[model samples]
Every structure is written in structure tokens, then in C-alpha cells.
Target: MKKTFKIPMSILMVFAIVFSALNLSVFAEEKESNDEYNFELVQKDDNIVIAKATHENGDELYATLDKATSEITLEAVEKPKGLLKFGDDKTTKYIVKAETIDPALDVVDVTIIDETTKSELRISPEYVQAQLPVLVPVVTWGGRALLLWLMEHALAMTIAGITAYVATDLISDIRKSNKNYWPAWIRNNNVYIGGDAFDTDYQAVGWVKTANSGEYNLWARTEAKAKEAANKAAGTNVWHQGKPTDGHYDHYHPAKPLVTDPWVVKLDNHLWY
Candidate 1:
């Protein structure tokens, strides 16, 4: 006789309440983008470098730099809600003028004073152009929290277990029809030499393959040497016999080949015949 275990409904209710409370604590609050600025170089129009930043309300903040004078100015169709400053101290301000142009990697680097920290932070051109456009929708986070909460309930857990069991059996059925074999290129191009086989330097040789077939008769020392001698005569690199990994077989095929085919031991010393 087999025994089965069941979970009490009271414990499941406790789990649901705890999971919901944790989700609400983490994701209940709404988030907003700060007026804190960053910049990216969009394009260059003659001597002027055109750049763009993102506004908190999802609008473009444009800043232009003059190549000749090294003067940069920020211009937007609508004025920003929070005033943009350029330094750590609250007094160091950037209204319409900047001191100099420091360019790197085709992007101009600029410093901005964080409104909350009252500290200087540099925003690179790449960050402004490449990264700033990605916005996380608040609704997606709320939906994710709701999905997690539902997953903790008893009914949903039962459904998940059943689905997982069905998926495993389906995968096993799919794999039954498939067979594992070596790649065609390896079997077609390479030759196998093994059974205490040693090269000119007495180095243990493993598998040997001809670069060009029908040029030379490749040799395997023993009949047990993966593949029959008759298979070698057929002008194919592979054989019906399996590969051998006995003795100090060559791990790295660094030997100079006598033939054009670089027949030698290779990495993962196993040979496919």
C-alpha cells in the first residue's frame, strides 16, 4: 500500500496571507523619474553637436555644443520642473553657459548636481542616448506581484505540479525518437588510430584523419582499433567501430602531420569512428 500526504487548508491560508502582505509591502508605492539629468550625443550638424535627454514627463531635453567656442547650452520646448545644476554645491549653477567642452568617444561629458544629494555626478553621452529611453511601466510590476500572490495559493500549486509532471513525460516522449551522434564534419574528415599507438616521438597517438581522402591509406594498428581496415579502404574517415581512450592518448594534437590531413590527437581525446 502507498501513502499520500495532504496539506491542511489552515496552513495554506497562512501562506497566502504572508505572501500577499510581502508583495504589498514591496510594490504598493508608485515611482517617478527625478529631474536629475543625463545627456547623450545624437548627431553633429557641422560645428554644432546636438544632444538629447529625457524629461520626467517623457519629453526631449535638447542641449547643443559649439565646436569652435566649446560653449554648451541646454534648450527645451518646455522649461524643466526642477532647475538643472552642474555641481555638488547648491550655488554652482549652469543656466545658459558652460566653462569648457570635454569630449570623449564622440560623446560630450557633463556634470550635474543631484537635487537630493547636492553632489556632483557626471552623465556620459552613451547613457543619455542608449539607456535613458527604456521606461518600466508601473502596471507590469503590479501584474507581476498579483501573479506571485496567486502562485502561493493551494489551487494554483496543485495545477503547477500537474503541469510540471505532464511536461516531463512529454519531453521524455520527444527524446525517444531522437538519436545522438557525432557531427558529420568530424566523422567525414578525420581518421582514427589507437591501441597503444605512438607517433615518431613515442607520443601516444589517438585518432588520425586524412585531410584529403584517397591520397594515402590511413592505418589503424589493431582490428579492435575503432573501425575495420576494410572501412579505411573505402576512402571515408569514419568507421562502424567506436573510439578508444586507452593509454596516454594525445590530448592536444600539436604534432606536425606527415600528410596534408592534420591527422593527430585533438582536444577531448575521444575519436568517432
Candidate 2:
């Protein structure tokens, strides 16, 4: 018969405890999250959008909604410390005066710059796709928000044909409501909804054909007016009603002309009249 040596139960118990401790350490290592992003962009309300960058983790950033370009701008702000709860600071708010949102592009058209060198900020494509859609709706307008949202959905629903007809009647009732009046040049018609050309409010309208950007119509019969209106309506950028001699940047000032009129001939390197 072969003699067999018995293993100690105490040693076996010690080995078992060691194995369990090793497994727990491995589990913790797997559970730790990779939070490398610098800011968390969140929409607090319909008119409240902000980026949180406190303590560890995000790039120091602030957001701007430019009224002139109808787009959002992201700038590098001094990284703030401690807790930044919503509505605590005015600097975090996104709206500039008379801001307009471009509905055709993704949720918001974000532009960033290298203020250090005045160049475009280098960012990955992954960031654009991940963040822009859920950002910057923190604008306050009662019906205009609804109108813009409807327009965005309408644009998304059809790209080529459906929108051409659907857009015209989208906001008919809302147009008559006095509070939400930002004059848009009425598409395919010669009339305006909220007011007239002589009203002289700061109009910030975008060029859109396939969706809801149509507003007030034209009453003037002059060829210059017609051409200006056409260029404004037909999606050509850099065309708007000009400021008058009085230096007021008002719309369609009668007997006054554009900063650079499409009709006027310049005296540079050409035949002078």
C-alpha cells in the first residue's frame, strides 16, 4: 500500500481567503469609471443652458449665443472652483440680446476659437457629434421657441419636397400673436406678418427655402428693393436692408441705400462714372 500524506485544513482555509481578496481587488479596478471629459453640458430649462466645470474633470469653458450670427460660441473661461449650481451666476447664461437659432443645422451651430492666436479650436469629430445636439436651447421666447422647434422638426422630416408646402402654413396663427414678432421675410409672398419695412426694428432673419423662415412680404416696386429682397430670400448670405445716411442700421430706408449696394458701381480699378 502507498502511504499518503494528508494536507492541512488550516492552510487550505488561508489559501481560500487570499484568493477572495485578490478577486475583490480586481473587481474594484474594473468598476472605476474613466471620466476624462472636462465639462458637462446640460439644459436646465427651455431657456437655461450651462456647462459645469468644477474641481476635477472638465476643460474650463463658457458658452455664448451671438445674436448677430444666429449661432453659439464656446470660449475658454477661467476654470472655476467649488459647486456651480444652476442660475447661480449670470455669466453662465447663454443668451445675448436678439439671438436667433439656426434650425436647419444640428441642434445648435457651435463655433469655437483660439483667442490666443485667433484661430479655430482643434476638436475631435467625436466631440461635435456627442455634444452639439443636446446643447444650448437656453433661450427665452414663448411662442418663438415652439415655432422654431416646429420648423426644426419640419426640416428634419423632409429634405427635398415635403417642406416646400408644409412650411408656409406652419405658424399662421402664431404670426398674428403680437408678443412673438421677429419679422421674417414672407416666402413666396410680398407681405410681412408682424410689421412693415418702415418699422425699423433690428431684424435677424436667416435664409431658408425648404422650411419655415418666411416672414413679411414686399410692397415696394423698385427694382433695387426687389433684387435685395430676392437675394435675402433666395439663400445668398451677406444681404440685408441697409442703414440710412443717419447711421441707423434700419431696414429698407426709402431713398437711402445699402452699405455696399448691389447696384452701385465702385470707383476702384474700374471705369468711373
Candidate 3:
């Protein structure tokens, strides 16, 4: 008879406690879209995007995206750009089947607007948290960091780049309210700009997915590792890295311009002291 190795529950509990102290979150490039921030997107063109939603007041919100380029800067450093308005509301943006982003939307530029101020409402973060909690948020690596980055740089092109770079199926699944997700193995390398599959050249958005798992990677962890974690938690051998026959794991980065924003600069600090 074959014997199975077993550890006492008490020891496992200790490991869990130690792991909690680590708070070792894995930073990833793409995040899973969920019901929390649902938004609808239509590719008007290869680059143009149109977002539409019925407001809480049953009015309407029609936002046209010029593009999300890394070059987006304040129109003028001396003055502030005007904000597109939203009233008092909280709901996820509908999403699936994303359109590619053009590398040129300005933070100060106006594309979406309401004829009246009563349509889409922006509520307090606290209120939104209280009202609409993410029962099961499908966050990416460094999930909290991604949220913080978005809150701090909502108008930055990095947001668009991430939207573009994230796994397409994760984006598509949110609309279907699906839990199972998949990604194309070949197409997801680095941003393919002006050429075929070259390991250089960046996309216009400039932000690539970097990790922060406290392993000194200066980048995000891999989906393979994520699955490995799940396997450990489940006490199963579900995580597979390439195959036993193959030596290398399957993974790659994606297209984008290089962004050196504050968060990115901080990420680079890993390379320094």
C-alpha cells in the first residue's frame, strides 16, 4: 500500500500566519475585469472608442475616447485641464472586446460630455465602497497597487495601455460574468509596434506589466505562479510550468511605450539601493 504524506493542521496554520505577515502580493501587468468597474466599449475604429451607459437618473452617458497614448501630458503645465463631468453615482463600467488605444488622448482634451449635469454621477470613494463592494474582485498582480495607480493617474495613458495589454479573455469574461478565462498564447508578448515579433520597441502607452512580490524581480509574477499558489492552497498538483518534456515556461511581455511615472520610478528603485 502507498502512504500519503501529511502535515498536522496546526503546522499548516503556522505557515498561513507567516504568509500573512509577508503580505506578498504578486504584481502583474493585466488585471481581471469584474463587476466592480463594468463599462461598455466599442471599437469605432482600430483606435477610436465609444463608451455608453444609461445613467442612474436614466439619462445617459456617452464618452468618446480619443486615444490613450503615453505622450498624454497636461496641455499646459501652467494651467489645469478641464474635467469631464459625472454626477453622484456609482456603478461598474460595462466591458468586453476592447478596442486598441491610440497613443494621443490628452488629459485636458474633451471627448465625452453631458448636455446636462444630472446624468452620470461620481460618488465618494467611501460611499461607493459602502454601496458597491467587490464581493469577488478579479484583480491582477499587485491588485491594490493597480487600483492605487488608477486612482492617482486616472487620466494617464498607462491606464489605457493596461486596458490594452491585459488578457483579452479576462476583459471578455467580465461581460459574460464568467469565472473561467483564457488568453492567446502567441500574441501576448511585448507590444508589437511598427514590426513583427521583435523583443524591442515599445507601444505608445509605454507601461508594461511589472511585478512586486517582494522577490526582487522588479516585475510582476506569472500566471503560472498564480496557479501554483492556487494548487498549494488546494493541496493539488494543478500548476504546470511548460511541460516536463520542455525546459522553459511559456510567458512573454507586451507592447507599449516606456513610462517613468512616479510608481514606475519607484519600481525602478528596486534596481538601485
Candidate 4:
């Protein structure tokens, strides 16, 4: 009985050793596979960030970065084209362009250029935060004051003033009034285009006055009749009130001709205004 137990114990030990050896072999293979390729940033030129990777076969792969989407692409050797391929080594190059980059955010694009077939493998940016709703705060204090002053009797005027004050406060609270005079989205992105991008149905009159001339720059209203009037007067793409610069409002119309002044509008709000 003792001999039988010893024989089984020895067999168990041998099995354990064999399993450990197999695991070590697997780990070594994994390490060797990972060591087959290495990456390095090679150059940054204007809107392009160039990177190079060396494969085990001594073949070099090139990549370009698209800063906007944080995507990398394999660059063609000669032309500014992409999708470059070499031999069967299957090395990939990643390219990142500077234009697509947001420095405030650590956005990066990585691309794998297949050396054998000249194909690309792209990795997109992972958005960490969800987009927040944009709200434009319009203060109606002046209008309320005017309404209060228009009351004839002193008592009546006082009552109206109180009502106005309460109403204004309620409206302001609902609007989540911004003291800085800009929408939260614009503030977050530090964008100041002097334009209106808000849902007009909530307010009768919304305008941003220029500091210099004290004239309305952009205006929108909830009243369908008012919007229709403004749209008609300004054409379908009407400037209810002109921007300080002619092109300031140009970006508001995407379909407008390229020659249109201020041809582009920065889109701070994810929603189309």
C-alpha cells in the first residue's frame, strides 16, 4: 500500500512539471511575438505627424496622423497618398495629421499599415464624455422693467413690478442663466462667433448686441410670424441683424457659395441651430 501511494505521488509531480514547462513556452512565444515590431515618432511637419515602426525583418513601416479624428493612416512612399504595402512582412505604419488634433484633449489616432497587402487598420478615438445639451440664456429684465413702468397707477405699477421680477426669475432659472453672456458649449470650447444658435421657440426676442455700435448682431424668436418676417426680409438666408463683420453670419449658411463672406461657421453645439 505504501509503494502504491508513492508511485501515484511521483506521477502527479511529473504532470505538474510538464504543465509548468508548457506555460513557460507559451509565455516565451508571446514575448517574442510582441518584440517583432516597435514604434517611434519620426517627424512633425505642418499638419502632418509622421511615425515609423521597425519590424523584425528590418523592414520599416511609415504612418501619418490625422489630428482631427485622431486616426493614423499608412502613407504612400511617393505621393501624399496612403495605403502603402511592401513585402509579406505585414508591417503597419500609422499617420496622424495635425489638423484633426485637439490639444486640450489627449486624442490620438493609431493606424496599422499592412506591408504585404498595403491595407490599413484604423483605431478611432474613444470619447470619454457625453455631449451636453446647449442652452442660450436671454435676459428679459429690460423688457420686464419697461412693462412695469408702463403701468399707470403707483399700486398697480408696484404689483406689476413684483410680478415681473418673479416671472423673470423663474424664466432665468429655467434658462439656467449664464452670467458670462455665452452658451455653455461655446464657453467650454472658447468659441465666440457672434451668432445665434438656439431653439427660438422659448423666447420672443433674442439678440446679442455688439459692444462698439450697440446694434443687434444676431436675433432669433420663437414667434413663427416673427421668424417668417425676418426670414422673408433677409431672404431665406436672412441676416435679421447683420454681424459686425459681413462674413460673421456667413457660416450660418452651409449651402452658401464658397465666395460668401466668412465662409465657415464653427459648430460648437452638436445640434444644428
lDDT of 2 by residue, 240-259 (tens): 44332332222331122235
Count of clashes, each model: 4, 15, 31, 20
Model 1 residue pairs with clashes:
191-208, 191-209, 211-261, 239-273
Cα lDDT for residue 221, candidate 2: 27
Measured over all alpha carbons after superposition, the RMSD of each candidate to the real structure, in angstroms, is 26.8, 16.5, 25.4, 23.9
lDDT of 3 by residue, 1-273 (tens): 999999998888777666554413234223323322333433344344454332222323334434333121111001111131224433223121112222222121111112233222212222232232232122111122222223122222222123322222123333343222221111222221111111221221122222322111111133543333232222222222243123223322221223453311122111100
lDDT of 2: 0.29
lDDT per residue as tens, model 4, 24-52? 32243212122555556576543445555
Q: State how far residue 19 of model 4 sits from its true place (Å).
A: 16
Each model's TM-score, in the order given?
Answer: 0.19, 0.24, 0.23, 0.22
**How many clashes show up in model 4?**
20
Query: What TM-score quantifies how close candidate 3 is to the native fold?
Result: 0.23
Question: What's the lDDT for all of these models?
Answer: 0.30, 0.29, 0.26, 0.28
Q: After superposition, how far is residue 105 of candidate 1 from its true place, in Å?
A: 13
- The number of the candidate with the highest TM-score is 2
Question: How much lDDT does candidate 4 score?
Answer: 0.28
Which regions in candidate 3 have their CA more than 4 angstroms from the true location?
1-43, 56-58, 68-164, 167-249, 252-273
